[model samples]
Target: MIIGLHVQVTVNRPLGSTHPEHHTIQYPLNYGYVAGVIGGDGEPQDAYVLDVATPVRQQTGYVVAIIHRRDDNETKWVVAPKFRFVTEAEVRKATNFQEKYFQDDIWLL
Candidate 1:
């Protein structure tokens, strides 16, 4: 089935000057549709559910792709090897909107 953009990420918190995490990187800032699924319930087909917009790919097998970052100053795609789901957390300390929007859903890692 086709699902929405599964943004599997690991939020590395900010540390001391010497202990700063380099993974603050945003990498691919955007994602696109990969697949879709049939949505429905046991209520005599009340409606078709579009689970495709949900980020469920995190539970499925890993899909290999390339992440090309220029070494010098060139705009191109480079291969960084395959990646899989890890975790996702909203940035809190960096922005106050996280608390304003996410409200009780805000999570810090």
Candidate 2:
């Protein structure tokens, strides 16, 4: 993903939402999918919105990083404020709730 491109995310799972099947896993950040884009999983590309404090149904933001899953074909886009920055560790921690189930790498642009 480009570092500064404004992306529209359609949030299927908003912040504080629980996993559809894994009810115990709560989302700490807004989790969604890029509108009109299909991913390697043959579904809408998944995305995680960071640094934003409130719950949101949808949002537009710049791409900050890409969460590449080594074991799976799907890749998740990390979206955040244009001027904000998050370290690799921070990204890892934020997405760990679900990402921990897969081998992954965080690529910051």
Candidate 3:
């Protein structure tokens, strides 16, 4: 339902950063959540930032897709810069770092 909405995502897990608990898992892209918005997990809405290579503190873009973890209850939003278009293949490749461990689907706009 949030697809096509523009939002600012606070990048808590920047690119190249290691997972807080799982050191073996690293972030290939910036990932964070939207402030004040609650998601299915009862926390800030989590998002995976796309279209950026370097580690950033935050990102402002449109919600391009959602990574729905079939086994898990959480859904990660995919955000991309203004005017930028993201494909399903790109989302898979960018989020494979962690999503690979779970059964998921790309919910596109």
Which candidate achieves the best TM-score against the true structure? 3
Best by lDDT: 3
Best first by lDDT, ranked? 3, 2, 1
Candidate 1 stretches greater than 4 Å from native: 1-28, 38-81, 89-100, 103-109
The segments of candidate 2 whose C-alpha lies over 4 angstroms from its true place after superposition are: none
lDDT of 2 by residue, 1-109 (tens): 3666789888889889999999999999999999788999999889999887888988889888888899999999999856467799989988999999999888886
For model 1, name the residue pairs that clash: 1-36, 2-35, 2-36, 3-35, 39-49, 68-78
RMSD of each: 17.7, 1.2, 1.1
Q: Scored by Cα lDDT, where does model 1 land?
A: 0.22
User: Tens digit of lDDT per residue, candidate 3, span 6-85?
Assistant: 99999999999999999999998999999988988899999998888999998899998989989987999999887466
Candidate 2 residue 32 Cα shift, in angstroms, is: 0.4
**Worst 10-residue lDDT window, candidate 3:** 79-88
Please give each candidate's TM-score.
0.18, 0.92, 0.93
Candidate 2, TM-score vs. the true structure? 0.92
Query: On a 0 to 100 scale, what is the lDDT of residue 49 in model 1?
Result: 13
Which residue pairs in candidate 2 have backbone atoms (N, alpha carbon, C) closer than 3 angstroms, thus clashing? Answer: none
Task: For residue 92, give model 3's deviation from the true position in Å.
Answer: 0.6
